[model samples]
Target: MRPDLELVANLIQTDARVLDLGCGDGELLHNLQQHKSVIGYGLDKDAENIGLCLAKGVNVIEQDLDEGLGNFQDDSFDMVIMTETIQSVHNPLLLLQEMLRVGRECVVTFPNFGHWRCRLHLAASGKMPVSAHLPHRWYDTPNIHLCTFNDFEALCAHLNMLILQRRVVNRHHNERSLINLAPNLFGSYGFYHLGRTT
Candidate 1:
């Protein structure tokens, strides 16, 4: 499991039901099921990933997340998780709302576009930075809605969601306490635990 996913697993209560959106290859779900005794269903658009999930005995569905979560009823699960995928979605805010609607709480992680390295690289090279966290060119990158820590917090406030916890990690996915000094500029990735306002 990615270090971030391990951290995410720590946030989940044991034996809870979880929904993982864009759950690549079901690694996180598999970990959650095996280690935490949680019941998890993964959703991914890729057939290969779904096959991997099936091989691992993890329940998975194939669907584009941007299409919306029409099948799941409100408050159907204890938690919904979207790891390192929010930036790739077409309408992140709408997806977030749907996530909150279907689950009591949601966990999200995204690459921080406002990291100083990205800014400095862009300033120096006059091109998009291709680092370990964001390793794609501007034209081909899937990250459409890239944002910073502050931007994400502002979005949460705007949506009237309650942020239960927040962590800033480096490119290696380890929590860095010094990053808190200037998370928007220093953090490479952001992990957020959020709940509905109500």
Candidate 2:
């Protein structure tokens, strides 16, 4: 398993029902099912990913997140996870609110566009930054709403979501403690545990 996934799995509580949005290949869900004894469901727009997840004995649905999740009732799951896919979505804030609406808690992760290396690249090279965490050229990148750590936090605050935990991940997915001090500039990626305040 990837280190980032391992970190995510560790954050999840045992025996909790989980919904993983954009769950690619079902690796994390499978691991959670095996070790934590958790029930998991996945939703992704990609048919190939859904097929791969189904082959691994995971329950999956082919659905676009941008269209919204109308079928799920409020607090339908214990936790909803959206990892590395938030930046690609059309309406991130609305999606996040929906996640909160449908689950008691939500785990979200996204590439940090304001990392120091990216800033340096922009300042020195005057070109779009490319790193191990975000390795795509400007035109071909799937990310549309690239955001800094602060941006996410602000959104969370605006939506009245309470932050339970926050972590920064590097290229190898190693968690970094320095994130608490300067997440927007230093962290390459941001992981958050959130819940609705009211």
* Winner by TM-score: 1
Q: Which ten residues in a row have the lowest lDDT in candidate 2?
A: 171-180
Q: Rate residue 24 of model 2 by lDDT.
A: 90
lDDT of 2 at 164: 94
The top-ranked prediction according to lDDT is: 1
For candidate 1, the 10 contiguous residues with the lowest summed lDDT are: 172-181
TM-score of each predicted structure versus truth:
0.96, 0.94
Off by over 4 Å in 2: 176-180
- Which tens-of-lDDT digit does each residue in 75-169 have in candidate 2? 88999999899999999988999999999999998899999998998899999998877889999999989989888899999999999998887
Tens-place lDDT digits, model 1, residues 78-123: 9999999999999999999999999999999999999999999999
